[model samples]
Target: GARHGINMNGKLQRLQEQEERIFSSSCENLVEQIIEKKKKKKRKTIETDE
Candidate 1:
Protein backbone atom coordinates (compact mmCIF):
# COMPACT_ATOMS: atom_id res chain seq x y z
CA GLY A 1 0.00 0.00 0.00
CA ALA A 2 2.83 2.41 0.74
CA ARG A 3 4.48 1.78 -2.62
CA HIS A 4 1.14 2.21 -4.37
CA GLY A 5 0.54 5.49 -2.58
CA ILE A 6 4.00 6.78 -3.56
CA ASN A 7 3.45 5.84 -7.18
CA MET A 8 0.09 7.60 -7.23
CA ASN A 9 1.58 10.69 -5.68
CA GLY A 10 4.33 10.83 -8.27
CA LYS A 11 1.86 10.48 -11.11
CA LEU A 12 -0.34 13.21 -9.65
CA GLN A 13 2.56 15.62 -9.41
CA ARG A 14 3.59 14.95 -12.99
CA LEU A 15 0.05 15.49 -14.24
CA GLN A 16 -0.18 18.75 -12.36
CA GLU A 17 3.12 19.96 -13.84
CA GLN A 18 2.00 19.06 -17.36
CA GLU A 19 -1.28 20.89 -16.89
CA GLU A 20 0.49 24.00 -15.65
CA ARG A 21 2.89 23.99 -18.60
CA ILE A 22 0.04 23.63 -21.09
CA PHE A 23 -1.98 26.41 -19.46
CA SER A 24 0.98 28.78 -19.53
CA SER A 25 1.80 28.10 -23.16
CA SER A 26 -1.78 28.70 -24.21
CA CYS A 27 -1.78 32.01 -22.36
CA GLU A 28 1.44 33.03 -24.07
CA ASN A 29 0.02 32.21 -27.45
CA LEU A 30 -3.10 34.23 -26.70
CA VAL A 31 -1.06 37.24 -25.65
CA GLU A 32 1.13 37.07 -28.76
CA GLN A 33 -1.94 36.96 -30.98
CA ILE A 34 -3.39 40.02 -29.27
CA ILE A 35 -0.14 41.93 -29.67
CA GLU A 36 0.03 41.08 -33.35
CA LYS A 37 -3.55 42.24 -33.82
CA LYS A 38 -2.82 45.58 -32.14
CA LYS A 39 0.27 46.10 -34.28
CA LYS A 40 -1.69 45.43 -37.44
CA LYS A 41 -4.40 47.88 -36.42
CA LYS A 42 -1.85 50.55 -35.66
CA ARG A 43 -0.17 50.08 -39.02
CA LYS A 44 -3.48 50.33 -40.81
CA THR A 45 -4.39 53.53 -38.98
CA ILE A 46 -1.02 55.07 -39.71
CA GLU A 47 -1.34 54.29 -43.40
CA THR A 48 -4.80 55.83 -43.47
CA ASP A 49 -3.57 59.03 -41.81
CA GLU A 50 -0.70 59.43 -44.23
Candidate 2:
Protein backbone atom coordinates (compact mmCIF):
# COMPACT_ATOMS: atom_id res chain seq x y z
CA GLY A 1 0.00 0.00 0.00
CA ALA A 2 2.83 2.38 0.72
CA ARG A 3 4.39 1.69 -2.64
CA HIS A 4 1.12 2.33 -4.36
CA GLY A 5 0.73 5.59 -2.55
CA ILE A 6 4.21 6.65 -3.56
CA ASN A 7 3.50 5.83 -7.16
CA MET A 8 0.36 7.91 -7.08
CA ASN A 9 2.16 10.79 -5.52
CA GLY A 10 4.87 10.67 -8.16
CA LYS A 11 2.28 10.70 -10.88
CA LEU A 12 0.61 13.71 -9.37
CA GLN A 13 3.91 15.51 -9.10
CA ARG A 14 4.72 14.87 -12.76
CA LEU A 15 1.33 16.21 -13.80
CA GLN A 16 1.83 19.35 -11.76
CA GLU A 17 5.26 19.89 -13.29
CA GLN A 18 3.87 19.49 -16.78
CA GLU A 19 1.13 21.99 -16.04
CA GLU A 20 3.66 24.52 -14.81
CA ARG A 21 5.76 24.13 -17.94
CA ILE A 22 2.74 24.62 -20.15
CA PHE A 23 1.59 27.67 -18.23
CA SER A 24 5.00 29.34 -18.41
CA SER A 25 5.28 28.69 -22.14
CA SER A 26 1.85 30.21 -22.69
CA CYS A 27 2.83 33.25 -20.71
CA GLU A 28 6.01 33.67 -22.72
CA ASN A 29 4.11 33.46 -25.97
CA LEU A 30 1.67 36.10 -24.79
CA VAL A 31 4.50 38.43 -23.85
CA GLU A 32 6.16 37.97 -27.22
CA GLN A 33 2.90 38.66 -28.99
CA ILE A 34 2.42 41.89 -27.06
CA ILE A 35 5.94 43.01 -27.82
CA GLU A 36 5.50 42.29 -31.49
CA LYS A 37 2.27 44.29 -31.56
CA LYS A 38 3.97 47.30 -30.03
CA LYS A 39 6.83 47.11 -32.47
CA LYS A 40 4.46 46.95 -35.40
CA LYS A 41 2.55 49.95 -34.19
CA LYS A 42 5.71 51.95 -33.75
CA ARG A 43 6.80 51.07 -37.25
CA LYS A 44 3.45 52.17 -38.65
CA THR A 45 3.64 55.50 -36.89
CA ILE A 46 7.16 56.15 -38.10
CA GLU A 47 6.19 55.37 -41.67
CA THR A 48 3.17 57.66 -41.55
CA ASP A 49 5.22 60.56 -40.24
CA GLU A 50 7.82 60.08 -42.97
Best by TM-score: 2
- Per-residue CA lDDT of model 2 for 1-50, tens digit only, reads 99999999999999999999999999999999999999999999999999
Model 2 stretches with alpha carbons more than 4 Å out: none
Roughly what TM-score does model 1 have, to 2 decimal places? 0.97
Model 1 residue 34 CA deviation in Å:
0.4
Worst 10 residues of 1 by lDDT: 1-10
Question: Per-residue lDDT of 1-50 in model 1, one digit per residue for the tens?
Answer: 99999999999999999999999999999999999999999999999999
lDDT of 1 at 29: 100
Model 2 whole-model lDDT (C-alpha atoms): 1.00
